[model samples]
Target: MTPDQATPLLDRVNLPSDLKGFSDTELRQIADELRHETISTVAETGGHLGAGLGVVELTVALHAVFNTPRDRLIWDVSHQCYPHKILTGRRPRAKTLRKGGGLSGFTKRSESPYDPFGAAHSSTSISAALGFAVARDLGASPEHGLGDVIAVIGDGAISAGMAYEGLNNAGHLKKRMIVILNDNEMSIAPPTGAMSSYLSRLYAGAPFQEFKAAAKGAVSLLPEPFQEGARRAKELVKSVTVGGTLFEELGFSYIGPIDGHDMEQLLNVLRTVKARADGPVLIHAITRKGKGYAPAEQAKDKGHATAKFDPATGEQKKAPSNAPSYTRVFADYLIREAEADPLITAVTAAMPSGTGLNLFAERFPDRTFDVGIAEQHGVTFCAGMAAGGLKPFCALYSTFLQRGYDQVVHDVAIQRLPVRFAIDRAGLVGADGPTHAGSFDIAFLANLPDFVVMAAADEAELAHMVATAASIDDRPSAFRFPRGEGVGVEMPERGTPLEIGKGRIVREGSRVAILSFGARLSECLRAAENLAARGITPTIADARFAKPLDQNLIRDLATNHEALITIEEGAVGGFGSHVAQFLSDEGLLDTGLKFRSMVFPDTFIDHDSPASMYAAAAMNAPDIEAKVLKVLDIASLAAERRA
Candidate 1:
């Protein structure tokens, strides 16, 4: 939206510098308007809503108090950065969030000077903030300049180990930095009574040197041994309370449990810290996710993500689906499997709903685990369960599974544990873009020795694969599937297990062949129809297992067909690459066979519609047809005929 069309305060405020002229009361108004603007923008664009809404006041207060672009204000995870983006000259493109060629849903360094550190995944902001502070103290010269560094991390994000690592280091360095814990999970009314607030205010009210010792004794969260030393010093501030001793133990001067929504309190706390802090300080500002909007506040997940919705009623305008989503299919099948097998259990790293494990959890709550934002722990935990003779399904997004790669290698793969990895979002996901794409799992998992890697051709195939993985009790196995609904294929009442390392022929043909390893089988079949209309019938096969190579099926295709093409919805080093290696090692390449590998292009595709992204990667149906024609040495002739 144009600055002219927005509310009075936002219209005048194009940048954080513009916030300087606004009074505290006016700043509160700007925050309120910014919240409305955020809701309206996300209602149209369908990006993260709740996190941004929660931080509307905090966003305004930070900018209004600090000299941003110079101060290096960082947001943890940055899903809450929409309001920050609006105050930093990105309001015009706010409605285009997560769209192709538009603003990112999270903070991006390339997008604006205010976004000094880019983040999508959680728990890295504290470290980045400290780096900036160290740089400023060392007199590093840059165009954006440098001042006091602040990392606004949420309570959920602060739970990760990496955040504590940054905190431990920062406390040791004693740098002049701020790490505001956006404590949305807490109540707005702090348990620490009015008396504690008065003491903190007094600490902030006094000059630095005069009250430094007294302030540290009173409000500084010291270790128990150190607290005894301050016993006499702390006696004046009797019955005063403060939270966050863990942070203080890590070396930070912890403050607050403050009401984050109160503009006066926020401004006062922020301004005091900006002037007074000489060491790492963690300000716990208690706010609520989906704070202002009633619909959002009441909804589960606090309306974290939404489709295009009616702003008044908060009703999503999603297109009706004829088929159950891939996630849903997996969940239902897993529940059925768990019904028969008492040993079957599931685990997901903070993505219960996204992976559809929430449904499974509802069926068997005791058998389900939601390890919060910790993929490494989730993977190892599954490995342990398997070791204890339990059938553990480590369900995780293909992108998030990357976080636990080392654990997979050491704890699972090397140990040869029977961990069934239900990998979801195994292709180009729409809206979330490259950061969330499941483009690498097949390549990484298939390359591991003694690992059984499979990809479902469709929802029915996904069902079968789930059963197959369950039966493989001696070794680790994984099956990948894409996002969104299946291709309206009829679901099986119960899945039947397929033989290990075997593939199935989808259609018989002549001259050339298209062997698919994943969800792209549908595209391959569509391309074959186009080829058949043109009097060329290509053999199509679903190479269910990426590893184990389906040697007999592969050899037969290479010997029978003049051309053999392998395609998958993965990056270059996955199924297709493995096939090429096998064909070469088996002396099949020496027989003048025209071999081609069709995979995602070697680049990070930006956010777009899934169809558009597939087209950009040249893996859509027409691209498949073109690959077939070119491999058959008829592409130029086909082009000439069309011309």
Candidate 2:
């Protein structure tokens, strides 16, 4: 059931403006209902549960204190925006979250006016809010008429250099803005690096008891009755391990290290700040990642994200897997290689479990590094390791690696470092949407010199590539694998590295040849089956290497077959474009060979099931078959003959 159905108080809140007359007690009741609703919705739809739960009270407080839409409110990462969505006229569609044509998992500018800024990546909110603040002063976005721009950033987000950069610039500009540091002490993984420790030092003492004890002069700033209890809080804050003076030095009015869950305290503090804030102010509100819901609070990732689940027990309802996931395969193969080589080390940008580096970390703790939300740093760090005579596997998601492209070019590629880039989620990832899609990596990386790019056609191919990457210690190399389960091929006990710049002929036929890259080999086979049934058997070859385009195999296919089709699960200018350029340079296209390159449609595809997404991009089995038939002019020739 929705929050409005459960609580009458929330039923009245059709918009943020509706929260205008809400009393502190009423707002608290609304928060409780919002938490339940978030839990209920996630139990059905399954998304970022813990983050939304943690920010329920904060969401209520922000809407109550500030004028949203008109006054910009941006969520860092926006993974914690479910509650905000529910409050802002999206409650009815909450059950359809992350599904095709449903509400986005993260805030979207097109989805609503309330979501002034969209975000799926972390450490971007502060910068975006600062821009909005500046824009308001300059009267740029007159349609929104922005005032009091707010960025509710998480503790983990502040660890990034971008956050600090934004903070520094905002401080210098002296804009009237608010930065709510939602210090939940947890990101997707437990936070890493110096900032997490510094935040821990900000609220070291037992605040309540200290405030209760020091009730006189220190507590005078708070409301009269709360003085006794709040005095101890002030004393506890005063006795901080490190001062908020660092923020003051940045020219921000530092406040809190306060209890984020407490509605009364949240209302009091936010109301006070709203009334008096002249320049950029930072409110550090301490919170639990999974607050209110017991099952979520007890979860391993603090219920960061989930599949549809039973609300009471928090038991996830997931489909049974036929084979091991590509992630597991990559991890196991890497571990196997690392066991043989002492020089091998692994690195990730704060995604240990997500990147499957957690397994490597467990086996070789000394060799694994989780460089917190800092992709640029992680890449350069790997470069340094490679320079120091270490085989550093810089494991990162394809999207996150984009943030480190500069470093990849400057530190790794240019220097010709033997850094192995393990790019995960290398295609259209479902649920998380276009923001997280790995569409550009193939095109971006393949263009660089001294870089060997490979895409695994199946799980077995992935293992082989891992071994291949381990063996290649001359220059930079990367191998990409998709997000979910592999194609259930018989895996070898130990991977034997394949010859570089080579591809394997899966099925040989005469009429038309389909050259496949990455995991689309299965679909190519399926297309072959369809064509075979129609009395036209097609040849299929898996071009494992994208950069060192299997020239011999590509040349053979073009020469033998009347029609040739190249398919990859990436944007244009990737495998297909490279192949086209090769054929042109070699004068192969001068022959009467029908050539077609089927890549992802030249656009950002939205969130949908992987199969459906591929279909939309016209790279599925049927699409492949259609491309072959059209290129061969089978339908036209047959129809003319029949007539």
Candidate 3:
């Protein structure tokens, strides 16, 4: 930061306490060095690059002004916490980010005292921070000495329903907390909804150079009911600070549209709030997503996420692709379906690119809707579309779909609307770990009445499932696919709809049958080859449908094979449990047929390669091979004893 100086300011700082010793100018220098360090760190270990870069000065200001760990600072989604993590004594391990047994990409309470609350999902920070504020007053942990509670939420995150709930509750309670609205005008995608438009209007006029003028300008934007109260609050602030009309209407001491990049402004504003704030405060800071880094700033997503890249050139280093990803395959197939049906439409909750719906949006802009991080609303909106006789595919990550479970059950499943759920990232997603891993969707969705749940075993099967879901007109249907590339299998030009509740046998064998669901079909095939080495030839079948499962096929497998094994890339109460329940009901297990269900263990697996994660869960190829042998060996031992 100080070019001529021999020593860098960041080298002296190991923790937030070290920042307290520095002068304002030195703190600014530290912020600059911190930004540089962040860029360098993420270059080595790619992660959420833009957010941390955007909040470098703010991260410094928060840590310098607030007594974090003692004073809780919760980051909404915590993707922006990279700079915060570096300052909080985690700089040494920064390179280990998002790896197995390494630092998490998001905040974790277990990781550090500074990270008082953990978050990977969005919009929960305000509520969590508010809870901390209330707990601080209640003296919940007297030993920790909680001082202040601050929540830094993005413009996109603040648009969600839960944030509004937190705002409403906080407004009523009027606690001494702070909510810093980081108005970057970009999230993983561009910010949407009325709130985004409102924020854009707040800073677009360039009237915010003077605080009083900004206050006067910001007030006129409020609704009639809110405007009078906003004017009173603006009058109350008396030229020292500005009133944010919407936040003020919610009874927060709205503060700024200040330059988040400005070290002086951030420090002054934060320090002023810390010294004198009595009620809830909202500081509006307008910043860029990829503030300092040129490559990130120029990129479409503002470099929200990336692979390891060159620090100098910002060119990413990626392995050569052997096949198209499941996401891309789904998007391509969905486009084909859309071409055939005029009523076919798509929806995603702020993750167009992630769900591969960005491609669909490009093809049919009118048919694709992005509901902006509000999964609950998105689900119901799709249901409404379905009710209006339009075929709507609600494409959401398996993890994100959990947020809309209640709506899915009520609006879609109860009414039996023909809403197609295209579930992406439906297994142990690597890097992002358990928080984002889609483990419960199969169990949760399959449990509902008349709900058709399918898991694609490969890219081609995924294409077929998309067509199958589109054809199912009377009831709701969902199909899940994993992250990453398909197994380089030959793909069909277009999808031919498969029969509901039926499965197909890939190979014929005797003594044992391995019935696989989802992407684990490939692993079953791999295990079969290994089993063949020992003269234990096992049959392999792909169970396409989880819910209305092919009972005839299950009965046949039980009747023929000495042992049957069910495997899926999901939690315990999913496909395996359903199959087991059916077998027990039919008295198939009563006839002494040995059976095993290989699934993810009861615990949450940490961030790792999917291979490592499955290995830990004992659901890999070797695990499958081991389970078959264990079941057959037990039968062999029983026979030996009988002899």
Best-matching candidate per lDDT = 3
RMSD of each: 5.7, 3.4, 4.6
For model 1, how does the per-residue alpha-carbon lDDT over 407-453 read when each residue is reduced to its tens digit?
Answer: 99999999999999999999999888888899999999999999999
- Please, what is the TM-score per model? 0.91, 0.94, 0.94
On the 0 to 100 scale, the lDDT of residue 418 in model 3 is 95
In model 2, which regions exceed 4 Å deviation? 1-5, 207-241, 636-643
lDDT values of the candidates?
0.85, 0.88, 0.89
Tens digits of per-residue lDDT, candidate 3, 81-191, equal: 999999999999999998888999999988999998999999999999889999988989898885999999999999999999999899889999999999899889997
Model 2 per-residue lDDT at 58 = 95
lDDT ranking of the models? 3, 2, 1
Give the TM-score comparing model 1 with the true structure, all chains together.
0.91
**Candidate 1 ranges beyond 4 A from true positions:** 1-6, 186-242, 637-643
* Pairs that collide, model 1: none
For model 1 the local lDDT of residue 587 reads 99
In model 3, where is the ten-residue run with the lowest total lDDT?
Answer: 213-222
